[model samples]
Target: MKLDILAIGAHPDDVELGCSGTLISEARRGKKVGIVDLTQGELGTRGTVETRYAEAAEAGRIIGVSVRENLKMRDGFFVNDEAHQLQLIRVLRRYRPDIVIGNILEDRHPDHGRAGNLIYDACFLSGLKQIKTAEDDGSEQEKWRPRYLFQYIQDRFYEPDLIVDVSHVWEERMASIKAYTTQFHSPAGTEGDATYISSPEFMEAVIARARLLGKRIGVPFAEGFLSKKNIGISSLDALVLQET
Candidate 1:
């Protein structure tokens, strides 16, 4: 199916952690959205790849995305090479999404930056007529370049070029994130070594960041994003702003 947006991340929960609120809000408006996880997050400290796949499926259900596909690339080892770009190009052409959401350009985790650059390149390459790719059904795919590519804000702070107000759907977004039981802060789960994001504080910080972004735009909550291209709007009145 043709998608309005395809959100890509380096790992299973990356989209959820970064842009799930925006995804959920857009899907509620009848937008067809999909997710492409570059890796299954096999290298995470807490959950196995099998468990992460299951949890990612649950997260997809919560966000109401039409589909979620994994590239099965090596966790933490995947590089921005020709092979990786070709795999992403195939999906990009197959979906023919109008927009693509990707990981932060730079983040605490190296994989996030690599995936961001890889996707950025693939999106551009997908539009090249000379580049060839095939669908799963073995049919030759047509070239498709998304109209917009966005970078979701992650661990590190960067001034966002765009902020999406997600106040109406914030709770649903949080629920979608909580669906990743094995990855996030779950007191009931089996005790294991805690990582940077496994702690309750990390979740709190994510929420806090949303609030800050929301406050900047006079909303209850929002998600921040950076864009490689300068954003344009038709009118100043269309922009949400803090009331004086």
Candidate 2:
């Protein structure tokens, strides 16, 4: 099915942690949104791959996305090569999304940075008619590239070029993030060693980060995004203006 937006992440919960709120809001408006995880997050310290997959599915339901898929690339070793680009291109052409939500251009995790660049390169290559790709059904794919690509902030913070107000759906977004019980702080239970993100403090920080972004725009909660190119605005009234 054609998608309005495809949110991609390096690992299972990356999209949830970064852009799930925005995705949730958009989907509630009846937009066709989906997710593409570059890896199954097999290299994570806590959760098993099987558990991550289950959690990702649950999160997709909570966020109300139409589709959620995994590329099954190597957890920590995937690189931005021709093979990787081709794989991504196939999906891009199949979905033909207008906008793509990608990982931060640079982040604390090396994989995040790599995945961001890989997505950027793939999006461009996917639009090239010369780059041939095929669908799962063996049909030749057409060239497709999203018109806009926005990078979500995670781990370390960067001043966002845009902040999406998610006040109306903040609690629901939290529920979606909480769907990954094995990955994040859970009231239910815990197994194995505690990782950085698995701690309660980390979850609190997540809420705090959203609130901080919201404060910048006088909203209760928000998600921040970065754009390499200047965004176009039709009118000043359409822009969210903060009172000085």
Candidate 3:
């Protein structure tokens, strides 16, 4: 189905930790939003692939996304090669999203950077008619390119080109992130051995990051995004005015 906004991530929780608040905010405004996970996150320390799938579904539901899909690329090893690009291109053409939000170009994790470049390249390549991709039924798929592409900040922070006000959906957004009980610290103990992210400090950092970004724009909470291209709006009315 066509989507107004499509968020892509290298792993299951990547989108949740990054742009979920923005997605939830948009979905609440009646925009169709979806998620595409590049990998099953099988390589993650805390959760099994099966548990990841279940958690991802629950997270999607909490975010109120119209659809969520996994491309099944190898976790932590997928490269930005033609084969992987074609796999991602197929989904891009199918979803035909107007705006694509993906992983930042560079991050602490190599997989995040690689997937970011992969998504960037695939979005451009998907627009070329000669790329030639097919549907599940063997019919030819039409070329599609998103109108705008924004990369959500993760792990490391860079000055963002835009910060979306997400205070209205803050609680729900946190709930979505907590859906992955195995990945993040949970009050109800998880089964696997604890990892860096499973620590309560990590979750605290997440909230602190949001508050820091929000303070910049006089909002209670926000999500920052980077864009290679300058963003434009038709009028000043589009700007959010700080409360007196």
What lDDT does the true structure give each of the candidates? 0.92, 0.92, 0.94
> Per-candidate TM vs. native?
0.96, 0.97, 0.98
Top TM-score model:
3
**Tens digit per residue, CA lDDT, model 3, 27-64:** 99999999999999999988799999999999999999
Q: How well does candidate 1 score on lDDT at residue 234?
A: 92
The order of the candidates by TM-score, greatest first, is 3, 2, 1
Q: Which candidate is the best by lDDT?
A: 3
- Count of clashing residue pairs in every prediction: 0, 0, 0
Instruction: Name the regions of candidate 2 deviating beyond 4 angstroms.
Output: 241-244
- Ten contiguous residues with the weakest lDDT in model 2: 183-192
**RMSD of each candidate relative to the true structure:** 1.2, 1.1, 1.0
lDDT of 1 by residue, 1-244 (tens): 9999999999999999889999999999999999999998988988788888888998899999999999999999999999999999999998999999999878999999999999999999999999988887889999999999999998999999999999999888998888877777876554689888888999999999999999888888999999988788899988665785
Question: Which tens-of-lDDT digit does each residue in 54-111 have in candidate 2?
Answer: 9999999999999999999999999999999899989899999999999988889999
